[model samples]
Target: MDPTFLSAVQLAALVRGGKIGALELLDHFIGRAERLDSRINAIVVRDFDRARQRARALDNQADKSAPLFGVPATVKESFDVAGLPTTRGHAALKDATVRVSTLPVRRLEAAGAVIFGKTNVPVDLADWQSYNPVYGVTSNPWSTAHTPGGSSGGSAAALAAGLTGFEMGTDIGGSIRVPAHFCGVFGHKPSWGLLPNYGDPATSSAAGTDIACLGPMSRSAADLQAGLEILAGPDPDETALTLNLPAPRATALKGLRAAVWADQAGIAADPETTAAMLALADALEREGAIVSRSARPALDPLDAYHLYLKLLDAAWSGRLTEETLASRRRDLARLKDSDQSADAVMLRMTDVPHRLWLGLNEQRFRLRRAWTAFFREWDVLLCPAFATAALPHRQDGNTWERRITVGGREIAYNDLLFWPGLTGGYHLPATVAPIAATQAGLPLGVQIAGPIHGDRTTIGAAALIEQALGGFKPPPGW
Candidate 1:
């Protein structure tokens, strides 16, 4: 087996046993990166010399039993890495915004993990595909013509290609989960504020500060846990809240009540995706987990998706100029009598008043309360991560309306946001687990959503699911 393809857990064990030096592991991954990264475009900027020096130092250290000690990891370029430029995939800001190495980066460094390089992201970390002028585009390891998903696209691609043990990325919308879904890896978006998002240049905006979350994306659930342990904590600068809670323990998998809401009556999931989720449910059932197929409390996936868009848009509202806001207000004024669609609601959010936003915030709280009550009867949720498998790469972000065929029916392109938006509504924790692959050889992932602040619960269940159904499968041509 290739050492670069070793899981973080395996690498930690190897380091502790002294069977292979941490420096050797770094060298192995670095060499693999040099060989494969050019085709995948996963790594945007690399610092192999610094990583080798640090790995050498870690090899000499006495305390090598840490969970991620000396493991090589990549960070999404949206996060600061000191010497590397934090472009956030925008070419213009390369000189203005310097990468100062945030708390998340520092924590990972403290854990004795070697930083090999930074991954690519969409421009300003806004799109679903990772492509920008700064570092070009990131291609999926499974298929070069498809996107790996963004803004964590590069992180997922790197992990899938065995370029690194694991990686860290920020998620506000579906940034973390979508990439994991597209790239066929494990990614966890912890409960709101579970991890710090401080010090990234992309997060410098006043409004951007409140909505974004930093989390882990890896090839295995264990790697996600390891990365989360290193990144979760209060901001050292006292400007952010602290969440230093211990990891939740799962004594066993038996008798754990889980909800199965693969597709609400309204949304149509692709046959391949629906089948993949059903297969996972069957596997979980055999694992001694009690599964319930119940109506999910009248959950409105489109509504939830729309609400998520509104909330996320508000987070970046400050970036809009007064003239732009006025123009949007004018646009909305002309549509006061028109019916609302998800797209219309998303467009209207730009001109929403403060009072209206306050009311929406209250409604969001009610939604959260409803989800809290719903979780009382369920411990985990198994659903689709996206509407389809990995999509072919398109630079203009205009491919979302191409009407892909599914289950003998055609669906709109942008409809991909609905399933993912379900978890975003209540600010719940979600884990993306790769279940199987499609007939076309593309990977399919299942999304596991849990109650707010119950990140470990979702992640723990995902870990068990991985054990029940064999974990990640390496992509060919890596």
Candidate 2:
């Protein structure tokens, strides 16, 4: 049986029913990756030998009830797989090997997933495009000229190219959702802290950062839900508490209240993206769901954008050297508070004072509360995932000077962070579900934002939308 387009859950069901052995599925995916990954460059590191052994061993078991049992998947390279280098695409760490697996990797393995390889990522997982000196670049399966969206670009590319069954990726600024949008897949950016980041090299600190989250990326919403079930919950050391994700608000689309925000004041989505969101809202209204096009949270878009930039930059400050921080501090001192340019905002937040960070944290909490109150009236908020579809490959090396064209107008590259940061900055749960395709066949998706800890609500809404409008259509020639 061809398992190319099957979801991880479907593959596991087949394995459990004895219709296909775990080893057979592993071999099928490995073969596909070997033959097709050269074009997209998604699967960068192969761990097929041990994965084969584990799959063969699993075939001998009778109880195969694990949600992802026997299914093959690839994880972002930033994640640690034992003995493999967990380089966040850094050339210096290219030969460095990890001694232990990350918590998510262990959890997924325990849930019967056959993780055969690691996917590509940008250097330090910082850019929206996934290209590094270590593993090269990953292209969108829809069109090689366009990127698959990074820092989880390779994971999305692999899934879209039929090279992997499922994937897990980290998201701070649309790393997971943008790729899902660009690749026409389903990706869930779970409620912050829902998934443990124990062993990932980037976030293995004593205290995890507030804005970043690790989540599941897959071709189907059901697979995303299944992956979240296996990966969510308290860390292994925090066994005193268990995670009980609340059930979705409602299973059916009807009776659900959805707020659609297709474009914000300063940010304009592509014409196709705007049309797709409006079309989705119209469809929801036709299906008996109450859709409001003008609804918005109490927070101001500019304030939220500044707050997100501050918190996101502060979260990443640990990576900067003392000299760099000192230089940035000097630069910040020379600038006035009126300077609201992207570089000025980033420089000011590079070395945030403890008290200032506390204030920002309080602001974030207030934003979360606003979202909570908004969700009390609206079950989900549908918005553009990004300003445009999969962007063309841009590798000029100077990211700060780079710009992206949206609706025929060039905007600062950082503007891409607006929509994702809207929910990400506030630590709310958001899911990306493909809604329509651009004129060139590039996929466009909408963000389903829900209340904090309302992960299942967003996923359920995406699933319902997916049911209404089909999800995860393979790219041509894939």
Candidate 3:
């Protein structure tokens, strides 16, 4: 059988059944990348020789029941892979070779995945478009003109184009979900502290970051579940700690409670996106699942979004260059006390004092509590992943200074963070599933968010959606 668009679970099964040798499977992906990666430009760094050796070793193993046995996969370039460059898309850091593999890479290798290469990313993984001086732009397989959704842009593009077997990416601000939405794939952002993230760019801290987490992006939700099982665990350093995530809540869609939040008051989403989300809700109702459109979390969206911006700024503040931080500090000095725009909040919170951060943390826990209460009534909350579908390549000036039109209304590009930050800020688990397409043929993804540690429920709902409606569809010609 042609394994072009087969899911990771299916590919692993093939290898276990002895239908394909591990080395042969690895070569299949490598040959495909060499022949077809020029158009998508997703796999930027190749390690074919080492991967082949590893695959051959796996083939010789007496037992072949590893969860991801013989799966030829790739990870986001920002992740550390022993001898590869961990340049998060910056040219200056290209020559810096990492001495050790990151935790996730080590875990994947231990679980029997042959990671042959690393994918591309935006400079410092800051923008929604994937382009840098180190690696050229990564284009969408659906349309070469548009982005594949970035930081993890290349990860999504590679999956959409059928260039890899499985992929993992990091998400601080829609890095995984946006790419999955734009490229019509599946992605899962696990609950905070669920997965250990020790392979970041600058630091090697054992403690997890506030809003960032490493998760899986794939062609199927079942692949997402499989990935989480392999990747999620306590930090190896903290040997005494153990992790035990619960199984999926709903076995079927018959009695699932789904709350739909298509458009928020402060955020202006495209009519097409809202319509698609509403249609998904209607589909759920027809499938014997309980659907509610009027139910809300009782928290104000604008207020929650603003808090997220502050925490986000603080979380990623250390990664910014000295020059950029200085510029923001100077800009903050000139801002009026009453200024409350998204950019203004971001600028003012860059070097936020620890004292004020304590207050923000207090407020955050309260909001998280509110979400917990809401989830008690609803199984999952469905919303738009982004304001609209994938946008064209935007490699102009600073991303914060750029502007784009959404739903016939022009707004600052960064202002579009409302959708991603709303649930992510509070450390909730969310899964992105492809459900509709715009008239222009661009894909639309619905965000399935559940309460903290409710990851299984959200993914279970996505499985239900996939069974009833449909799952990942290959972009046009491919």
Stretches of candidate 3 exceeding 4 Å from the true structure: 200-203, 336-339
lDDT for each residue of candidate 2 in 1-478, tens digit (9 for 90 to 100): 7889989999999999989999998999999988888999999999999999999999998889888999998999999888899878778887878877999999999999999999999888888899999999899999999999989999999999999888999999999999999999999998999998888454366577778999999989999899889999998786779887789997998899999998877775688888888999899989889999999999898898889988889888888888877877787778898867566677777655799999989988988888899999999999988888998999986565687788877777876788888889998999999889988999999999999899999999999999999988999997
Cα lDDT for residue 452, candidate 3: 88
Q: Could you tell me the TM-score of candidate 1?
A: 0.92
Model 3 per-residue lDDT tens digits across residues 144-237? 9999988899999999999999999988899999999999999998898788878644535556678998898899989998888888888777
lDDT of 3: 0.89
Q: Cα lDDT for residue 423, model 2? A: 86
lDDT score of residue 283 within candidate 3: 84
Query: Model 1, 315-386: lDDT tens per residue?
Result: 767667899678777767776556354445666787678999898888788888878888877888888888
lDDT of 2 at 269: 67
Residue 31, candidate 1: Cα error in Å is 0.8
- Candidate 2 achieves a global lDDT of 0.89
Give the clashing pairs for model 1: 400-413
TM-score to true structure, per model: 0.92, 0.97, 0.98
Question: Candidate 2: where is the Cα deviation over 4 Å?
Answer: 200-203, 326-339
The regions of model 1 sitting more than 4 angstroms off are 95-99, 200-211, 239-250, 321-339, 397-412
